[model samples]
Target: MTRKASGAPGQDGHDDLQRNLTNRHIQLIAIGGAIGTGLFMGSGKTISLAGPSIVFVYMAIGIMLFFVMRAMGELLLSNLQYRSFIDFSADLLGPWAGFFTGWTYWFCWIVTGIADVIAITGYAQFWFPDIPQWLPAIACVLVLLGLNLLTVKLFGETEFWFAMIKIVAIVTLIGVGLCMVFSGFVSPAGRQASLANLWNDGGMFPNGLMGFFAGFQIAVFAFVGIELVGTTAAEAKDPERTLPRAINSIPVRIIVFYVLALVAIMAVTPWRDVVPGKSPFVELFVLAGLPAAAGVINFVVLTSAASSANSGVFSTSRMLYGLSLKGDAPKSFGTLSSRSVPSRGLMFSCICLLAGAFLMWMIPDLMEAFTLVTTVSAILFMFVWSLILLSYIAYRRQRAALHQASRFKMPGGVPMCVACLAFFAGILVLLTLKDDTRQALIVTPLWFVLLGVAYQFVRRRAVAGVVAIQ
Candidate 1:
């Protein structure tokens, strides 16, 4: 799997991206990536689906994905020349691996970005009911685009603060929740807050095996951007130090944010009473007698959605720039602004995000549109994670000397990669059993088929142009 150091023309010793992302920026970016709108808005649905068992679901996904990130970290640090998993995939597997992984990751972010835009519109409606939904969606895209086009440092700063807000909100919620539980706080519905709520009604697996399985599809979607730190490898100031610290904190983030937050919500409200399609965080605050809960949660959720969309634009643009440099995308996408930003690629991704706003205008039922797109996004993200694992397997085999000599090697190596892959396959099977997820699962393959067709055309043009140059 080893390739020439050049890998390909225009790809060797030619990174235009600035390493302005300091240790703080990288850590926060990774933290921001882990905490998205999913926990704020999607947890209710998961709670409704799997009850208290959802805690275990979040933990399982987090643990498995940590291994995926470990593999990604090892690959990125193996050669300072590699930027992200996309680069190493191309170097270790072939150019096709880079093309497919890069484009698929871009698509994944696009889908997520669109969903976030639609969510922004909905959140705005809470404050300005008469305002048209598409306006806010469009406005959100424009603002993020403007900021991203300026400099990579600004993007990092924006995420740092956005992630800070989310962290503060969750910590506050947990603290308030613990008080409610200890004080025996009683809600308007007459239920008393207690840890016993976890098992009182029907136990953890309240809905049984099928119900537990139902949680996986949505739960997988909740952790969509967990691997986003990989994309910042090109711009991170200290990839070896910061990257490992960020990746190592996954377990703590999972426990603090997802597990404890959900535990708090259920402890106050009970699994059976948790409403579907509504944010449990808001509900907990309200149940705890916070008059400003609605306004506060609305503001927090709005920021969470915006943060996700901002991340999408940053990651997808970088991916396009990477692809272009490899000759897998248009040459123009490789151009950089004076600030070392991929301005053209950023604009291109923002233009695609406009399609999301268009969908909000066209689809009367915004939630339905969000559901379909998010499911597809989840499926596409799974493919990207699988590629990282597969690439790790290849890296271990083909670059055994590097693997043995490296200080930041993946803990479990080949066997761990295989286990994570199997776990992901199990989630796919779970998706098939649910009607909503099944539809997306069926639609997901078409994306790969399209990528395959596009790859052939690109490869053909490369070969023909080379022959002509000769």
Candidate 2:
């Protein structure tokens, strides 16, 4: 996501997000963005696709995006003027660039929000067998609406606690699983849990080169929201310090949180038996002989869903508010309540998510909802990531002089940019091979097409109005 400088002057000297989001909020919000339903529920699919090599797929994507964040950080810190990626897109690539970046990122959250709704119902089923799924789905939407409509700090606070729950769960699982791996704890099923399990099931990429590449298809989606740090620059206090800390440590984050987590999961439960269609975490707890495993995990997954949807609401509203200020969206979206929050934008995004939940219930099977939500979320991520590439290209062309002064410049420069873009393009190709992802791949471009048409209208009006004044 390319961002323009947010410090640009407006008639009122202050745009919508004037107050600084607290330190606790920024840190937890960062965690909130990093963890998602993808880790809890979706990891099984990647394992199934590439066996133990799923770890490699995640690491590869995480590494590439670490570079992207470096590039974004350099630009953002250079001026601290940009509010978000779309803001940078405008400054570097021009107005239309911001329009597309803003809206595309907006779609990213919407798709994610729908997926959260899908997950909530699934979790609810584990607790209430007789309850109709849609009942909880509707309830989740209302909860998200009220949570988001409060204050930005409240949003951050909510995310902080939600993320705290997820982090604690992962850390506990990792610590406990490590003990079992070292203690030689044998499973009740007569299987010994060991680190050797990493390669025991055919040595990493058991399915060969083809399986490794296929893992990329779902793996890319797993890291979709990792760059959300860049988007929060608008509200972050001491962003120069906070942003760099978050982006620089991504490599460590991947190893500790994702790679290690997966390694432990597979070690406890062999790859062959790990249910591809269900959460391997939940299954492992059950394997560990915990009768309450299902209930404990059900709670974890529910909070994970709330965390993701909460983030979606926060981001989508900001994107709209940013778009409106740039004159691409309806003016009302730019309006803030007395609380300095973009209340209209908040309400609008949540309402759209509510509508999406209703549409999801119309589907026959719950699993299909997961595929559909993930596919569209992946596509939205593709667009947002593509914009970051284009923004880098634009930054190089427009501000060559700043390369040296750039506080956090991207290393390897254009070469690295080209390579990362190519990596993303390859993943896009992989999406086509899976029929489920392919539908989203085909339909996603239509969103950009529609945005392009709307942009033309807005651009023409701005041009004509300026001409008349002259």
Candidate 3:
């Protein structure tokens, strides 16, 4: 297999995106991707729904996705020409696979970006109650857009700091919560913090089997951007060394960031007492009698949302740039600015992000709108992940020699890929068990239908151009 050029030349003589993202940038970006806004904001609801069982729900999802990432790592390293999963899906499958996978992944980030924008407005309200929600929503979009427009390295630097803030906050929460639990710290509610709180109430399965299943709906959103490292392959300084290091660390990050963090929160505050509408991270601080720290946690959560929105902006633009190179999107999106940033695609994504602000104004109940968009984002992301697995399956069958030669081969091989696909199918069924997610699930197919129609038009135009040239 021949490697394709990483980038095309622009009129300004910039050949491609400079390989400026160092090992540290890729590592932190992977960490940031693993830890998402959903964990901080949505964990409270998950606890209320699944009780202590929610811990298992997170672990289950994390384990399955680790395999998915392993498969992606193997595929990516098999041929460095493959910039992201989008390219591999196209190469292993048909052109239609690339079209659907690329566009859907682009839409996945856009929808998730909108959710982050909505989350940002709500977080801003924590500091400025009287400010219009749209003010912060639109403000976040512009700020991230400006940073992204500067350079890809700037995007990496911004995410590095943003992810660092999240890391510090989670570690502090876990540390503080453990201290409270060990000391038998008593809360204002006259309840003592203890590890026994995990099952002292209604036991681990407090909400029963159905409630455990419901946890997947929102919990899946927490893992939305876990595969974001794949998008940085082109900009990464050392693809062979950096990509695997980033992918291999995912399981450890999930355990520390999601599993242990949630355990600490539940142990400190008990699943029964956890409020569905509030953030457990902030609530745990207040419960520990540190009002000032709670305020600080709110600021951290706000930055987490901003970081996710920034990532969405960067990945969506790159996806569009890739799609345009394949002639699946407009040619202008294939061009880069003087700084080698995909400015056109970046602006287009920002404009779509503004729709979140518009939704805030249009819908009187913001959480309701947030729930709708988040479910849609989760569904679309599952499609992208599924495509990655499918591509791996194709690679194993068609490129057996590549698989045998891979230094970073996926574990369990093709069988694990099939199992991951089955697991995602189960999640889709779980989505329908709830009213809100069910609606989003039903509406998701329409997106693919639209993509199917658009793909035909793109193909026809390409064919006509070839004939005219001949």
Over 51-143, each residue of candidate 2 has an lDDT whose tens digit, in order, gives 999898888888888888788887777666677888888888888889989988998888888888878887898889899877888788788
Local distance difference test scores for all models: 0.90, 0.81, 0.89
Segments of candidate 3 deviating more than 4 angstroms? 1-15
- Model 1 poorest ten-residue lDDT run: 1-10
Better of 1 and 2 by TM-score: 1
Q: 1-470 in candidate 3: lDDT tens per residue?
A: 11233465545333366678999999999999999888998999999999999999999999999999999999988987677888899999989999999999999999888878887887788889999877888889999999999989999999999999999999999999999988989987888988898899999999999999999999999999999999998788888999999999998999999999999999988898899988899888887778597679889989999999999999999999889888888888887787878888999999988975685568887677789889999999999999999999999999999888899999998999999999999999999888889899989999998998998899999899999999
Error of 2 at 370 (Å): 2.4
lDDT over C-alpha atoms for residue 189 of model 2 = 79
Candidate 1 ranges with C-alpha deviation above 4 Å: 1-14
Task: List candidate 2 segments past 4 Å from native.
Answer: 1-14, 468-470
TM-scores of the candidates are 0.97, 0.94, 0.96
* Candidate 3 local Cα displacement, residue 42, angstroms: 0.8
Give the C-alpha miss distance for residue 74 in model 1, angstroms.
0.3
How many clashes does each candidate structure show, in the order listed? 0, 12, 0
